[model samples]
Every structure is written in C-alpha cells, then in structure tokens.
Target: MKEVYINRISKYLPNHPISNDEMEGKLGIINGRASKGRRIVLRNNQIKTRYYAIDDHGNITHNNAQLTKEAIVGLCDDDFKAEDIELLSCGTSSPDQILPSHAAMVHGFLKNGNIEINSPSGACCSGMNALKYGYLAVKAGQTKNAVCTGSERTSSWMMADTFEEELQYLQTLEDNPILAFNKDFLRWMLSDGAGAFLLESEPKGHLPLKIEWMEGYSYAHEVEACMYAGGDKLEDGFLKPWSEYPSDQWSKKSLFAMKQDVKLLGENILVKGVDSLKMALDKNNLKPEDIDYYLPHISSYYFKESLYKEMIAQGVEIPWENWFMNLSKVGNVGAGSIYIMLEELVHSGKLKKGDKILLSVPESARFAYAYALLTVC
Candidate 1:
C-alpha cells in the first residue's frame, strides 16, 4: 500500500470572531426575548469568541458550500494546486440542502473539473470519516491526491427566525414562551467555519503529517441518540425522522432545531469515549506516554475536567500539558471542529519533527466516535 501524508491543511472562518457579549445581537432573540440559558452555556463552554458566517445586519455571508470551497482553495500552491485535485470528500451536520450532497454543492462553488467526491454525513466524527476516505483512496493508489473538507453553516439554523413560531405556539398552549432547553441550548454553543486537508501519496509541504493509523467505532446499538436535529425523539427513544411528519409541523414545532438530551449526554458520553480510546490504544500497541500531543474534539469546557478524570479512571491518561485543544478559542463547529484545531496547531509553530499527535472525536449524536494518530514529518 502507498503511504498517505496530509501535505497541506487550511481553514476558513467566515468574517470576524464574534465576542460573547455580542452574540445575542448577532443571532437575535426569539420573539425579542433574550435567551435565559446563554450565560450559563457560555460560562460552561468557556468560549469567549467564535466565528459566524453572518454579517452584522443578520445577513448570511457564506453558506456551507462556500465555506468549504474557500478551505479547499487555500490548499493550492506552486507544488500542488487545486486544479490537480482528483477527489473531494466533504462532511457536515448542517448541509445547505438535503439533496445534491455537500461535496457536489462545494464543487459547484469551486468551478473545478469533475472528480470523484464523497459526502459523509453525521456530527463531529464525520470530519475524520472524510479524512479516512481520502487517506484510503490515496493509500490504495486510487487517486494521487484528494481534498477532504469538514464544515458547518449552523449559525443560520440557530437564528431567532427558526424558533419564533415555535416559541409563540408554546406561549398560546402552555403559557411558556421560552424555547425548549434542548433546542435553544445549542444556539449559544455552536458557531460556523470550514477546514480542509490535502491527502497525497508523497509529502509536499514544509511539514507533513504521516498517517499512522485511524480507528472508528459506534455505540448506537447500545444507546439512543443524545443530540439530533430534523427529527423528534419519542418516549421510547426512537427518533422520528422529519420525513415521517407533516411539513406544517416542521416549522410550527421547530422540528428541525438541534436538540440534545443533556441528562443522557452526561451519563454516557465521557465513559464511552474513554472506552473507545482504551480499545484503540491497546489495538494500536500505544501507551499514553507515547503521545506528544492529544487533539481531542471536545465540544465544551463543561466536559473537560470530567473527561480527563474519566480517562484516568480507565487507565489511559494523557497528561494535561499534552492535551492540545482550541475549543475555547474557536467554539464548536461540529464536524469542522477537529480540523479547525489541527489547522491552529499546525500554524502555531509548536510542532516539531517526530512529534506524535493523537486525535479523538466523540459525537453524542448516537454515540459515534473516531480516533486517529499522526506523526509529524
């Protein structure tokens, strides 16, 4: 098999990083009522600033496809250019549309020639899934180079307009105008951005990350979805997909708003993450000490200490200093988050040759997870 190396990496964060105090004005308040949970969620997430694709006047600046196109275009240079890309793999939870796939939409924006493309759909783990597709394709000599992207345009989805009707409906029926915690909590937590990586058979950039190994797992059989959108979970924990319901209820009940089972999330997320990491480390014959940097796609600081404690309890502890994270700086971009963190680290001038970096991404949307290892070259 041919060796795969991530020769070039780039990220595109639309517009400026919006500060905490300015979020409500930017996102607007549902029915002109300020969010009751914003302070608490931001305090817990520890995200002081995050980027959004919307401008000051509440107009969208970029959609998911445009964000992705910019990131892929960023990879072009004198050695290997975007014109040479042979495959495109994209991943996202918030796609611009239901059909045409995210990769097709992105390619439309690029105006690049037709090439093989794959769209992996899910939450945060989708990013690694996209990378794995490109890596395996290159390794198998199916393509000389591929551009894989992970991005989200969730800011618009979280806007007040999406929930005003639902909140008003609740007010008429239950005298509760407040948006449901499950639906509204995510607005304060999610931002928007895009990131892309170039996978090549040979290294070309100044410093390339050689693919050591990648592992993925899912606990869906053992548990139900903890985070979701475009559906409503029933009493028996069965997710009622959007198609099964009437189109009228979609907007009336805000059926498409992102929701979370906070209690369920707290119960299973960290524990399963440790278990997944434990199995992967053992199978890869790796010890905690062997990792020089740990880039985990942790969504919020609310889980930071608890996750560390969980890993230690499972005997797969990596010291605090070795943990490389930018959640507080970048916010949670869902599938785009892990790539965002890597882009920051690569440009931060911190990594040296021979450094071993481990990536762990766990999604509460059905408890799926992906782990990968890379060596700096």
Candidate 2:
C-alpha cells in the first residue's frame, strides 16, 4: 500500500481564560483545597481557555455549524482557495443540524464546488476517526487532499440551574427548593474549542508526515452507558440507564450492533491497548521501540495514567511529566484532542522528521480504537 501523510495541522482556542480560582468564586465554595482538588483530580482537567461561538450580541452560540465554519476557515486562511479543496470531514459529538451534518456547514463556508463532504459522529473519538478516514481516502486515491476538523461549543448546552437541580435531586432524592438554590458542578471543566488539519497525498518531492498503519475496534456492551438528545431535559444526566420505553430500544439495538473485542472495565490496560498496538505494528513489521511519541486520548487524568502504565509495561518508556498534556489547557475537546495534540507538537518543534507517533482512543462504550505509527516527515 502507498504511504499516507498528514501535511499540515492547526488549532484555535478562544481568547478568554477561566482559571480554577475564578470557578471556585463562581461556585461560592469556601474550600480552596476542594476547588483545586476537583479541578485537578476529580475532573481530570485544568483547562484555562476554550473557544466559543459568539454572536454579534456577544452571547455564546453553541451551534455546531457556526463553530465548524469558524474553525475550518481559520485553518484554511488565505493559502488555499475553497474551490481547490476536494473533501471535508468533521468529527464531532455535537452536530449543528441532524439532517445536514456539521460537515455540510463547513462545505458551505468553504464554498467548494463538487466536493464530497461528511460529518462523522464518532462520539469522543470522532476527530481521530475523521483523520483516519481521510488518510485512507487519500491512500486509496479517492481524493488528492482532505481536511479534518473537530469543534465544540458546549457552553451553549450548559444550563447552570439545570445541573444544580439535577445534583440537588441526586442529593435529596427529589427536587427541592433548597436544591434549586445550590449550583451545579463548576463550569471549569466544560469549555468550547476547535481544531483542524490539512492532509494531502504525499507527492514525489514534497516531504510529509507518513501514516504507517491504522486500525479500529468497537465494543457494544453497556452501549446505554452514554447518550444525549436535544433539550433541557433532566433525565439525560450521566450514567443514566437507557429508557424503558419501547421506542427507546433503539439505544439497546445500537449497543447490540457494536459488540467490541475487549471486555468491560477490563483489569488489563496494557494487555488490551498495547496488544492492539502490537497487532498493527506486527502487520507493518514494526516494533514498539520504533515509535518516538505516543499520543493517547486524554479522556481523563486517571485514564491517561492507566494508559501510561500499560505502555510502560510493554517496554515503552515515557515520562509522565514530559508527556504532552493538553487537557489542562483545553479540557476534553472530545474527538479533537488527539489531532490538537499532534498540531501542537508540530508547531512547538517537538515532532521531528521520521519520528513515529502512536495514538490510542477508547470510546465511552467499552471498545478501544488504536492507531499505530505515523512517521513525521
């Protein structure tokens, strides 16, 4: 198979910064240790800034379409005309419109004619999924160039009072007036941001980042573990069970369709993620020591730690402090986290030519998707 390469990448975050101290004040919590601990340990995020889609009135717009447009345009700049682009894909959990998909908005903004565009709703791994698809498309000679982007304006979905109400209900086992006065979890962990990458078929003369190999897997058990729908409805909170209504069986059916290879809450992380990584490497006749950088999904601090330990067990040495940790600056951008990290590495001069990069992402569902070996060129 011909080698696939990622030519250029970029990321954008809004100008504002929301510190833990500011969040503590907003939450009216007297315990500084509690605030900082929640900021670092509980939430597994210490993000300072996240880009939001704001309207002329300066109100935050959580519309996925608007954010997608802004992120793609910002990445393209003036270098390439929209007409020259061939394909565009958006990886996002939040979609602007159900029918048109977020990719359509990006296509409309770019104004590229006769282009094939798609918006992939791959949950948290959507961004990496989009990139993988783009690489395959280029490698298969389907397109000369492709653009992948992930953007989210979660602030629009946040209801301060609603979160508080939900928390109060959980605490009191019923909706109470006292609970209404209490606020939800601090908004520090939730923010808005976007990222984009320009990938092209590596030409004869121009050097580019080469994709060595990629693979994907899915697990369907506990599919109902995570879900979302439009509205301020309170029942859609975390770890809520799938509805008992007959119509809600769709969630169960979807989960049944996605049965994955790994078991739920499996005790072995290295055994699973590293084993998948090894399979990809063995397929390409590569080795773990060949990789120079490992970019695993930053779902949470604990998850990252587990992944690190697993990698270490596999004889891949990586320092926790020196590892590229961006959740502190941008929280979890869902699918965009991996791509954003890669872009940062490139811009900061950390990634060098021929350096191998390994990426791993686990969906909320038990399934784990792993990508191994991207050589920087």
Candidate 3:
C-alpha cells in the first residue's frame, strides 16, 4: 500500500464572529422572548464567539453547499486547479436540502467539471468518514489526489422562525423562550463553517501531515439516540422518523429542530468516548506520551476536565499541555469541527517534524466515534 498525506488544509468561517451577547439578537428570541437557559448554557460552555452564515436578522447568506465550495476553493492555487480534482468527498450533519446528496450539490456549485463524489452523512463522524474514504483511496494508489470537505450550515435550523410554530402551545412559559431545554440548548452551541483537506499519494506543501492510521467505532446497536434532528423520540427511547409525521406537524412539533437529551449525553458520552479511545490506542500500540497534540471535538469547555478525568480512569491520560481546543473561538460545527481543528493546527507553526497529533470525535447521535493519528513531516 502507498502512503497518504494531507497536502493542504483550508477553512471558511462565514461572516464575522458573533459575540455571546449578540447570539439571540442574530438568531432572534423565540416568540419575542429570551431563553432562560441562555446565560447558564453560555456560562458553562464558555463560548465567547461563533460564526453564522446569516445576517443580524437571521437571513441566510450561504447554504451548506456554498460554504463547502468556498472551503474547497481555498485548497486550490497555482499548483492545483479546481477542475483537476479527482475525487470530491463531502460530509455534513446539516445539509441544504433533503434531496440530491450533499456532495452532488457541492459539485454543482463548484462547477469543477465531472468528478467522482461521495457524501457521508452522520453527526460528528461524517467528516472523519469522508477523510478516511479519501485517505484509503490515495493509499491504495487508486487515485493520485482527492479533495475532502466537511461543513455545517445549521444556523438556519437554529433560527426563531424554525420554532415559532411550537411556541403556540407553550402556555407554561409566560415570559421566557418557549423551546424545551432539549431543543433550545443547541441554539447557543452550534455555528456555521466549513473545512477542506487535500489528500495525495505524496506529500505537498510545508509540513504535510502523514496519515499514520485511522480508527472508528459505533455503539449504536447498544445505545439509544441522544442527539437528533428531523424526528421525535418515542417513550421507549426510539426515534419516530420525520417522514411518518404529517407535513403540518413538522414545524408545530419542531421535528426538524436540533435537539439533545442532555442528561443522557452527560451520562454516556464521556465513558463511551474513552472506551473507543482505549481500543484505538491498544490496537495501534500507542500510549499517551506518543501524542504531542490532542485535538478533541468537544461541544463545551465544561467537558475539558470531565474528559481528562474519564481518560485517566481508563488509564489513557494525555497531559493537559497536550490538549488543544478552539471551541471558545469557533463554537461547535458538528461534523466539521475536527476538520476545522486539523486545519488550524496544520498552519499554526506549532508542529515540528516527527510530532504526533491525535484526533478524537464523538457523535452522541447513535453513539458513533472516530479517531485518527497523524505525524507532522
């Protein structure tokens, strides 16, 4: 098998960063009322700013596909042309439409002529899947190069209009936002952005990241859904498909609203993630000291200590100095989070040759996780 290297990395954060105080103003308050959980959630999450693909009044400026196209364009320059891309793999938890796979829509916007494309849809692991697919293709010598993109355009779903219909039934909330804690908490957490990576059989650009290995695991069969959208949860912890609901009930029930069982997430997300991490480390014969930088796609800063403690319990503690995160700066972009982190570190002038970077992403939706090890060269 041939070696695969990430030749270039690019990111596109839409518009300007929205400050914490400006969140509800931009997303709009639900039914002209502010959320009671807003301050508490922001305090715990410790997010200062995040980007949204919308204006102050919540009008969409760029859809998911357009955000992805802009990121891919950033990977092209004098040495590479958009038309010359061989494979384009796009991954996203939030897409612009229901029909036509995400990659197809992105390619349509790119107008990069004909090219092979694939779209891997999941929560946080979608981007890892896209990257692994491209990595394997290049490693197998089936393709000389591939362009992989991860993006999220979830700001549209977080808007007040998306949940206005549900507010009609909120009699208990006299002056506060009407959304349930499950649905409303996500509004302050998610942001819009895209990240792209170029993979090739040989290294290019300064400090190309060599793909050492990729590992992934799913506990969906053993675990119930914890984070979800476009559906409602049943009494037995199963999700009722959005297709089964009447069209009129969609907005009324907020079927498409991004939601989370916060209690369930707190109980299982950390333990499951550490379990997957232990497996990957054992399989690869790696130890904590081997990782020079640890980039974790975490939703909140509150989890920083919890994750470290959980890893210690699992006997895989990487030191505090090894951890690198930008959640406070960029917010959570779901599947796009890991790609954005990787892109930032690739050009931060922090990694030296022989440095090892460990990446971990956990998706609470169905409990899927992915891990990868990269060596700076």
Candidate 4:
C-alpha cells in the first residue's frame, strides 16, 4: 500500500486563556464555589483554562474564515505555494454561513485559489473523518498533497445571552429555567480554535507521520440525543434543523443552541468509545500493547479513570503516563480538539523517532468514534 504521511500541522488559538475562576464571573453564574451544578461540572471536566474567540463584551473577535485562513497560512512553506495543495478538507461543527460551504469560504479567503474542496460538517468526529478522507486520497495517489483542517468557534454557539433569552421564554411558560436549558453546563466546557495539517505522499525536509490505519464508527442509537447543538427537537423525538424551524425562535440569536444530557454522556462515551477503538485495532490485527502512546482528545478529565479501566478490560495495558492530553488547557474545541492536541504533541519535542502514536476522538452530538495510528519519523 502507498503510505500517506502528515508533514506538518498548524494551530491557531483565538484569544487569551480564561481560567475557571474567571469563567464563573464571565458566565454570570452566581457563587461558582457554592453552586453544586457548577462545582460538579468543574470537578468532572477538570478543565482549568480555555481560550475564547469572543471579546470580554461577548462580541466575536474572529470569524470562522479568518481562523481557517490563519491555520492554512501555518501549513504553507516558503518552498510550497498555496496552489500546490491538490486537495483541501475543512471540518467544523460550526460554520459561518449556510450557503457557501466553510471550505469554499476558506478557498475564497485565499483569493479564490482553485482546488478540490471538501467540507465535512457535523459533530466533533468530523475532524478525524476529514483527516482520514485526505489521507486515503493521498494514499491512493489521487492527490500529491492535501490539507486537512478542523476549526471551531464553539464559544459563539454557547453564548450566555442566547440561553438567557431562552430562559426568559421558558419562564414565561412557567417552566424551570435550569431544567429547560443546559447552557450553564456547556458554557464553561467548549472553547474555540483552528488546526490544519499538510499531508503528502513523501516527506520533504520535515518529519512526516506515516499513517498506519484510520477508521470511524458510530453507536448513535445507544446514546441518542445525548449532546446536540443547532436545531429544534420535534414531537417525533427528532430534531428539526434550525434553518427549517421558524425564524422567530432564533430572532436575536441565529447561532445554534446546544442541549446536552450530561448523565447519558457520562455513561456512554467511555464505554462505547473503547469498544469502537478495540474494533479498529482488531481490524488492523493490532493490540493495545502494540501502541506506544495514546493521544486521546478527552472531552473532560471525568472520564480519564473510566477510559483506563475500559482499555484495560479490552486488554490494552498502556499506562496513564503514556497518554497525551491538553483538555485541561484547551477545554474541548469541538471538531478541532484532536487536531490541536496532535499539534501540541508534535511540537512538544517529546517523541522519539519510530514512536507509535494512537489518536482517539469521540463526538458527543452524533455519538461517533474514530481512531488513527501513525509512526513518528
């Protein structure tokens, strides 16, 4: 098989870091140390600080296209022109517009540079899926080089005002605001960033990650509607796209509102996520012991213990010390989390040549799981 190698990666984080204590005031929640819900979320997620693309006044500092452009710029070399990119894959959980695809907008930002553009928009797993698509294309000799990117402005999605308005409406109906909205839980969880990778068939003047295998799976039915953003739940228990729903419901805030079932998420992600990882490893005839390092994009530290226990049950004995994670610093950047985590590791100067790294990603909204293995060169 013709091997595909990821040559380099570029990551762009929008703004200054916001600590948990600062987030309490920024989010307008009273007495964070006293609120049981806030404390549990903080304790469970273990996120200390995260970056936001919005300003202190809750205005967007950068749009999706600008963030994507910055990440793409990082992928360029003085030797390689932007046009040399044969394939471009852009993945995101949030897009700037509904008409022109996010990838198309990125292409436009590059002076309308022409190249085959693929935009995979969905839950968090969309990033891994986009990377795999580009990798497979390069491996098949369809493209000499490809750029795979995952970017998110999730802070824009979980804005406090949106929930405040929703709460006001729910209160008018005499409904419990806390029960009607989950924004308070999510407001402190998701952040914003963009990351891109330059992939080629052969390495050039840089260490390339030789792709081993990549696969994706889903068990949506097992944990349906556990986490979701954008769209209205219907009478049939399905969600109607926000665009299809009445505009009045989103008059002030058109961005998608996220609703999550925290209990179900805790019960499902680790258990089902490991099962999917085992399947991927099995398909490649490899075992957990064969993996040298685990680069898991954990949504929170709450699952760290469960993940270890589950991996052990599945016969993989990799230790906690062998795992690479940045959730504590970056929080969860939606589809971009895995890409940023991978970039941090590559730039950290911690890996030796021939180290086998396994990357795992799980998406809550769509209940998707994905994994990829690579050998550092």
Candidate 5:
C-alpha cells in the first residue's frame, strides 16, 4: 500500500579500462597458446569491455567499499546532506574485510551522515536484495530516505599467476574438452566494477522512476554449484561446480532444494516481474502495447539472451531492442546492474514519466528477484 521511489541514481568505473585485446594478449602469452586458440579473445568479442580497479603496481584493486563510497558521492548532489540519509545498504561480494561488512566501511566515509548501515552478502543478487530491503524500509515508514549500492573489485583478489594456474588446470582435464572450454570462457567474462543509487520515500519535485513493488524468490540449490570462501588461496574466488554434482541426482535434488528455498526465489522473481506488470496494466487495465521499457539483469551474454527467450516463450511481450545490454561493457556488477541501467536510462532521457519498467534478475542458487518502477513526472 506504500509507495517507494528512486529519486536519484549514479554509477562509477575505475580509471583503468581493460579492453578485450589487452586481455587476449595477456592470455596468449600466459597459456603459450596461439592467438587463435586463446578463448579470451573470442569471448571478449562478445562483450564490449569491463572496467578494473588497479593499484599503483597496476594490479587489479579489490576495494569494493571504496568504490561504493565513490559511487554514492558521485550520485549525491551538492544540496543533498548526509544527515538526510536514513539508511545505507551495500550489496557486494568483495568486502573490505572478511568480518566487517562493506556497509561499515561505506558508512565511515560519510562526512555528515550518521546513518544505520548494513552490508549484505547475497552473492550476485546482493544489489537487488539491498534495494528491496531499502524499499521495504521506506515503505514501512522506518526510513524516509535510503541508499542501495552494489560494487565489486574482484580483480584485487586475482593474482597475476591465477589465470595461468586455472588454464593449466583445464589443460590437465583434456578428457573433458567441453568443460575446459567452458571454464576458459568464464575466466574471460569475470570482471570488476561498482554501481549505486539513492532512494527517497516521497518525490520532492519531479522524478524519473518510482518503485511500485518488489518481490524476491530464492531456491537453495547445491552449495557446490556456486561457492566462494575468502582465504589466502587463489582458488577461493567464484566457483561454479555444478558439474561436480551427480547428473541423475542433480535435477531431483536441485528441484527439491528449489521447492524448499531456491525454486521459490526463482518463482518469486518471475511472479513479481510478470505480475507487477500485469497489476499495472490491470489497475489502468492497459494493454501490453501501452508499456514502454524493460530492464532485466545483465548477468552474462548467453544468460541475458536465454532469459529474454524464456520470457518471450512464457508469453511476455518484451521489447528486445529497448532492452539495455551493458554487461559486455561493464561486466557483471552483481546487484548493481539493474540500478545502474536504471540510472543510465534516466540520464539519457530514454525513460519518460508514465512509462512502466520491469526489473528482472535470475541468479545462481536458483535465486530470482523482480520489481516494477513507474516513472512519475
């Protein structure tokens, strides 16, 4: 019954621009492979480019908290005061410290704002999850204003020899050639970046987007499918071990897990995305033709395309051309992708008042999140 709106949004990338060609050069030399055989070159072609935080030594920087702070500062106008901020939530995988969440680090950076902050570790869904929490907080009258941020500095966790070791590990699995190639492809897709947004309960003058409703669906799948633990070892980064689970037992076990946790997440995401749009239409009772834009999670190139296809198959009319695709350029900024895209649309004047936008995010662990925002001029 309560309304939540996104008053402002902003995004930031590191100064270092790591192009595919540069990555290819590094890969070719490291794997002792010909330029043609190196998969990074090929996969990089599918993606636009990604930003990386680099240290003075030119190594990838892993300061997600710093990035989140920088992004928030950039989003806030000079007139905005930190004291006005009631909540600060960060959705991120890379924390400044293992014990202290990134939210604490971000809170310390604020000069005038004494706000309650929370750092969430929802893996890839963190950004969206944080946004949902902020929306609920405002809707429940617990806060008048809030900020949700999603940032990652995975490169900081990566070592120069890391790729080499992974490549070598794949070479050892010569018997599973397809699996090797898949692993190689993923290596190229991994990137580092951060994005953030500012949310207010009530619009001051005019705003581009207003949050109508949000819902989350989480399916607890096999722990090994996607697992990450912080440690000194390089292998502790993102791991997709779906193959490790037994095939015959996977679907059943995964389905069972989904029924209990993971499936509900996916179902919630799908239901929210579809139902929110339907509710908007039903309230006004407008046809599908009346809606204007849609922004789904830019997870991966293949994943994005597959999701669109699935939506279409489910009878959801989506504007394929209007869909903003940025993962190729920015890599996957985890929970930040949808909000970052939302900001881009507003700044670019593509999203207009009265237009309906559907936000969808389907992640690993059988998690799904969906929300609807109507531009209120």
Candidate 6:
C-alpha cells in the first residue's frame, strides 16, 4: 500500500480571545447564582482564554464557511493552487446551514473549479473521520493529494437569544447550576477556530507526518442522546416533530437549541475513550511505548487524572508527561481541536526527524471515538 503523508498543516484563529474574567460579563453570570458555577467550571476546565469569531461588542463576525475558507487558504501558497486540489473534506459539529454541507459551502468560497467533496458531519470525532477519509483515498491511489479541514464557530450556537430564559430555568433547579446549565457552561468552554491539513502520497518537505494507522469507533447504544443538537428525542427513542421546537431553533440559522446530558458525558467518555484507544493500539500492533508524543483531544483538564488512572489500571503505561493538551489556550474546539494541536506541536520544535505520534479524539455525542498513528519524518 502506498504511504500517505501530511505535507503541511495550517490553522486560523479568530482575534477575540475571551479570558475567564471577560467571560463572566459576556455570559451575564455576574452576581447571579450561576456565578459560582461559572467559576467552578473555569477552575475545573483550566482554560485561560479561548478565541471567538465575534467582535468586541459580542456579535458574530464570521460564519462557519468563512472560517473554514481562512484555514484552507492558509494552507495554500504560490506553489499550491486551490483548483488543483483533488479532494476536499470538511468536518464540523456546527454549520451555517443544514441543507448545504459545510464542505459544499467552503467549496463555494474557494471557487476552486469542480472537485470531489466530502463533509463528515457529527460530533468532534468527525474531524478525524475527515482526515482518515482523505488518507485512505491517497493511500489507495484514488487521489494524489487532498485537503482536510475542520472548522467550528461554536460561539454562535452558544450566544442564544433565549439565554435569560435558560438562566431562569437553571436558577430553579436543585442540581448544581454548573451541571444544570450545561449549555451555558459549555459557552465558556468552546470557542471558534479552523484547521486544515494538506496530505499527499509523497512527502513535500521536511517534517512531514507519515500516516501509520487509523481507526474509528462509535458506541451509540452506550451513549444515546448524551450530547445532541436539533430535534429532540421522544421517550420511545423516536425523534420529536421538528415543528415542536421554536422555528428559530432550526439548524438553518444560528440557534442554541442543543440538549446535553452533561452527567452522561462525565460518566462515559473517560472509560470508553481509553478502551477505544487500547483497541486502536492493539489492532495497529503498537504498544504504549511505541508512541513518543500523545495528542489527546479531551474536552477539559477535569478528565486528565481519570484518563491517566484508567490507562495505568488497564496496563498501558504511557507516561503523563508524554501527553500534550491545548484546551487551556484553545478551549474545547470540538472537531478542530486535534488539527490545531497537531499544527501547534509541529511549530513548537518538540519532535525530531523521526518520532511516533498517537492522536486520540473522543466525542460525547453518541460517544464516537477515533485514533491515529503517525510517524514524523
């Protein structure tokens, strides 16, 4: 089989970096009962700042397609032509519209003639799925090169018009506001960013990462409706009528209609995520010692201890120091986290000519998980 290499990677982050202090005012939790909850969330997540595609006054500055285009264009130069791209793959948890996939919208922005496009839409793991699709295509000789992109503008979904109502509901709940106001808490955790990777069957320059092995898993039954957006689920597990929701809650526009079971996410992601990682390593014939760098796209710092403990309990002895996390700076970028982290690691001057990297992404929506192995060369 032909080998595939990520020739280059690039990212585009919005200018507004919202700090924890600023988040208090921005989310209107100041002096409210939710204030303490917000502080606890900030302390637990350990995210100092997160970028958002919004202005100083807190209005959306760019749509998802525009953010994705910025990332795609950042990957190109005089030596690369947008028209020459053979395949374009985009992944996202939020999109500007439902009918036209984010991939199709980005294609319109590129105006890069006609090329095959695949948009893997789902939870965070979809980003890995997008890259895996392109990697498989290149390795199978279907295309020589491809552009894989993961872009998100989560702030738009977070800044809902019904926030005051949500807060009112939270104030009445007996549970911790941090847990009761899951969506509101997420507003502080997720931000806006875009990342793109250019992959080819042949290496283009120094420091290209060769794809070794990749695998993906979905435990839908185990995590039913844990984290979800759009149409509500009925008691019988059937989808409720879309019309039942406020018209504004539809995916056609910026809406904060997600219903998340935060408790469910906290219960499942760590254990199942480690299990998925072990399965990937086993199938790829790799051991914990084989990976020199570990890039884990976890949602926050709260999971770090649990993850390490489980790895040890399961006999995977990868050191805690071997892991790298960027949630402190970028927050939970959802699908774009791994790509951004990989790009940052590439520029951080950490690895040498040849090193093994293990990438893992766990998505709470139906608990999709993905893992990949790469060799830096």
How would you encode candidate 1's per-residue C-alpha lDDT over 112-213 as one tens digit per residue? 787999999999888889999999999999999989888999998888899888877777888547888888889999989999999999877778999999
lDDT of 2: 0.58
| Residue 211 alpha-carbon offset, candidate 6, angstroms | 0.6
Stretches off by above 4 angstroms in model 5 are 24-45, 55-57, 60-62, 111-113, 163-183, 221-290
TM-score of 2: 0.75
- Candidate lDDT scores, in order, read 0.91, 0.58, 0.91, 0.79, 0.60, 0.82
The root-mean-square deviation over C-alpha atoms between each candidate and the true structure, in angstroms, is: 0.9, 6.5, 1.5, 2.8, 7.5, 3.4
* Candidate 5 per-residue lDDT over residues 145-201, each given as its tens digit: 788888776654443344454444556766332213323433455566667767776
**Model 3 TM-score (2 dp):** 0.97
- Model 3 agreement with the true structure over 227-247: per-residue lDDT tens digits: 999899999998998999999
- Model 5 scores a C-alpha lDDT of 0.60
Worst 10 residues of 3 by lDDT: 169-178
Model 4 stretches with alpha carbons more than 4 Å out:
24-36, 179-181, 234-236, 251-255
Q: Which candidate is the best by TM-score?
A: 1
lDDT of 3 at 1: 97
User: Judged by lDDT relative to the true structure, which candidate is superior, 1 or 4?
Assistant: 1
Alpha-carbon TM-score of each model against the true structure: 0.98, 0.75, 0.97, 0.91, 0.75, 0.91
lDDT per residue as tens, model 6, 33-136: 44445777788889999988888886677898899899989888889988889999999998898878889999999999989999998979888989999999
The digit string of per-residue lDDT tens for model 4 on 1-377 reads 47888988899998789988877555554212323466678888999888888778867788887788788888887787787888889888888877699888888887636799899878788888889889988999888988999888777665555556655665677644452435457766788889999889987655678988899898866656777766655556576777776777873333276777677687788888888887888899977777777988887898888889988887765787779899998888888998899899988888788999998988878578989999988
